[model samples]
Target: MRTNYEAHDIPYRRKKAAGWPGWNSAEEVHDCIQTLNGLLEPLEVASTADVCEIGCGAGNLTDTLADRGWSVTGVDVSNVAIHWARERCRQQNVTFLRGNICERELFAPASFDLIIDGLCLHCIIGEDRDRVISNLSYWLKPGGRIVVFTMCGEPKGKDRAGYDPKSRCAFSGDIAVRYFAKAEEIIDEFRKESLQCTFQQVVDPPNEQASLRALFEKPR
Candidate 1:
């Protein structure tokens, strides 16, 4: 099996500084931003709302959200990435912090109006993954929203260069595996915990990398 460190390899700041075009490419990033923006169009978030981004590597989405006038706080496990985000996203309304999502304590209860979880979930496994999920309930305000983008419950192609999905638990694949979750599984988890799904979509890139993006709301 693969370790979490192996799965989350490559310093985001190093790649950003070297102009690595981000995980996939500029096209992927642009499409993600545009699609997420469109998905949030009818949400009606106030300009004064506080937005917190989990796993905001290099502040890519954090910067975009800040540009939309939200007070943004981005947290990532990478200190290098946090430093990079601070330098790259200079908006006065934005702040970047470094910490494990499972142990983060910088925010008070019922703090954020919106929490962004980008493509970071798929990189973790085992009890660590569960801790992150459970911790989400503590960080969000009642009636707040969470936007999650992650790999789906599809079979990985052997021919593809991407990580493979294992049977049973998503962690059984390998050290380099990218954990995937079904939309239904995600919704069910939230439902059991008193959250409701507002929207869900499976996005397939030209490269055949399919992902699910979902927006959920916690009951007030």
Candidate 2:
């Protein structure tokens, strides 16, 4: 199955660089990076921590994480995105891998101290959720933390046409599957898989950018 990236990567990358609406927003980019760093602060993420950033578009956030002194590995499904991310985040500690994060083999088992998902999880629903969480579980070292920002409010009706309230899974457009979760639902999704919820907060402002930022930890 092809993803939105496989279909629209070239166009998205161009629009992203051109500062087009819906595709380009420096404020959103800033929000993503700053929020991640803020989350890492509470976790006391050390300089030596091995960090993986999922859907690391253009390295806006990934480069910043590398600057924060961590060894950062940025993963993206788009070869085009990964190309720019590598160039954008040129650093001794930063590396870029082009592949699906849902595939466990993309990374070694128990290899990372932290995983950051900036608007990635919201796009994965149903069985794909299990694939993603399994990869996260496999790659994260014991006691490692995962910080994710996802859609938490009412699903955007236009994009979420076949959303099931009972399951909180939304199928958007032909190939897109999005998920929306309540705060409790967010905690429950991870707790069921032995990942403990450490922190959860709703970001309610900035209009269309409202999201839920949650942190989960793998047991040591």
lDDT of 1 by residue, 1-220 (tens): 4455432335564577678654546787787788668767878899999998888877777888999999999988777677777877899999898877867476677888988887777666655666676677678989899888877666456424453445323433445445566767766766666778888888765656578788889888
Clashes of each: 3, 0
Best by lDDT: 2
Give the top-scoring candidate (TM-score). 2
RMSD of each: 3.0, 3.0
